[model samples]
Target: MLYSIWRYRHFILASIRGDLKGRFARSRLGAFWFILHPLAQSLIFSIVLAEVMRTRMPNIDSQAAYPIYLLSGMAAWGLFSEILTRSIGIFIEQASAMKKIAFPRLCLPVIVWGSALINHVLLLLAIAVIFLFFGHYPGFAWLYLIPGMLLISIMAFGIGVFLGILNVFARDVAQFMTVFLQLWFWFTPIVYLKSVVPEKFQFLIGLNPMTPLVGLYQDALLFNQRPEWMNLWPAIVVGFVAVVVSFMVFRRASPELVDAL
Candidate 1:
């Protein structure tokens, strides 16, 4: 798979560019739409929940703390969700092209991953600018975002490809995932602080693979503190297992994928 991807590297890059172009081809604002959703969400939450949650932020002293915290979590969650969402339907969406064209099937997920990564980087830049506007500046700890986001993307990509293959066989898988992701969002503590959750429910939050990853983003960007690396172990383990399983499933499923689509 790696060799095939490398051999078709140019095709993947072009496909990514084409996907981005087609996404905003009709919109005047173009790429701004990418950041607008999350930015608007951050603003709405800042207005509605800031005061209620501001005091809950233990060590953060800034009045903009909650907004910054929200954006950080949003940034992490948005990337993971976008990849998973797009990936789930990619094979079916490209069914016609897949039937007629001879490109590697693996290329589809790679394109989704690359395109989502570009959009995510833009969102991060927007959040960084917002941080400055709030009189907040990132320190050395901000570097944690690199590993943090990489881990997130890998995990999302793995699980997404796995689910994408399953969706090709069972159409209802797509619908179920849509509802599941919405619930998953609330469970991840993106809009609300984890510290605010009751202790009895804390273990439930911890069971979520995304909690530690999102917390890493909040710690690094919102609080300007180094993330607790040990916390990422579970996500790391899950990501590795997911990626390995995805490859195995994809290899076994590839023969039947086009027919199902």
Candidate 2:
């Protein structure tokens, strides 16, 4: 698969480039628009909930803490959700190309990852600039974002490919994820601080694989502290498992894909 991907690298890169430019091509914001949704969300959440949860939120002792904290969590969540949501429909959207062209089908997922990675990096810088706006500059701990984002991307890519393949059979899978991701977003503690959640309810949040990952982002970017790797390995394992499952599903689906489509 890797060799196949490498063989078709030019096509994948071109597709990704087209995807980026074609998005918001007429708009002034263009790619900056990628940062708007999360940035707006962070502002609103901070304005409404910041004071209410001020004393309770863990890192809210500073004036800029809540926004930074919220943005960091959103950054992690956005990357995963963007890939998963877009991936679920990749096959459907690319049906014409897949049927008419002779390119590697796996290139679609590669394009999604390439686009999402660029989006996340842009969002990260946007978040950092916003932090400066609030008079806080993130420290060296921000370097942790590289590994942290990569881990989350693995999980997102795996799930995206799995769902993208599944959606080729049942269109409803795409519809279901629209609702599911909303619930997933709320479950992720992007707005409310995890420290504020009660002990009994912590287990529910823990069940969410993204919880620790989001916490790790907050710890690194917002708190300027190192993440505890002991807690992160479980999510990493889940990511690996998802990748394995994705490959299995891809192998199974590729054989009948044309007929199914």
Candidate 3:
């Protein structure tokens, strides 16, 4: 599958280009809208929550720090959740193409990841600029964003492909994910500080794999601290397993998917 995808590398890039161009084809701002929409959201949310949670961060001493914290987490969560959400409907969206095409089916999820990564790049760039505008430069700690986003993206892609395969067979899987994501968001601590999550309920947050990943982003981007590497290993192991399992599932199910559609 790896070799096959490489064989058609140009096709994948073209598909990504076409997908992006079509997405922005009708809008005046086009791709800028992607960055603006999320930028505006982070700015608005930060303004609202800064006073409430500004002091939660120990490394940063200013109220303006809240959006930096928030957007850092969003940078990670947005890539993850967007890929997962889009994965649910991907097979269905390309059902006709699946039936007719002889290309690798794995490319479908890759396309999703690639597309989300494009948007993620924009968001990260926006976040960096915002940090600069606020006089909060990241320095050396900022480099963590690359590997941090990679690990998160790989893990998210694994979950997405697994869910996508399931959604293909059970249409309800797609519908259920919509509601599942809403609940998942509050649980992940995107807008607020985890320190504010009460001790009694902290165990619930600990059980969430995303908790540590998002924390990694927050520590690196918001506080300019090294990520809690001790806590990150377990999540990395889970991501590896998920990627392996997803590949096995996709390989076994690909031939049958065309029939199902």
Candidate with the greatest TM-score versus the true structure: 1
* Candidate 1 per-residue C-alpha lDDT over 75-113 given as tens digits, one digit per residue, 9 for 90 to 100: 999999999999999999999999999978999999999
Clashes in model 3: which pairs? none
Model 2 over residues 130-173: C-alpha lDDT tens digits? Answer: 78988888899988888898999999999999999999999999
lDDT tens digits by residue: candidate 3, 1-261: 889989888888998998899999989988888788777888789777778787677666776678877888878888889888887788889999888878998888888889999999987887888888888886788787787888888888898899899998999998998898888889988898888899999998888888889988988887787887878886788789989999999999988998887
Residue 182 error, candidate 3, Å: 1.4
In order of appearance, the predictions have TM-scores of 0.98, 0.96, 0.95
Question: Looking at model 2, which ten-residue stretch has the lowest summed lDDT?
Answer: 52-61
Q: Number of clashes in every candidate structure?
A: 0, 0, 0
Top lDDT: which candidate number?
1
Better of 1 and 3 by lDDT: 1
Q: Model 1 segments beyond 4 Å from truth?
A: none
- Please state every model's RMSD to the true fold in angstroms: 0.9, 1.2, 1.4
TM-score order, best first, reads 1, 2, 3
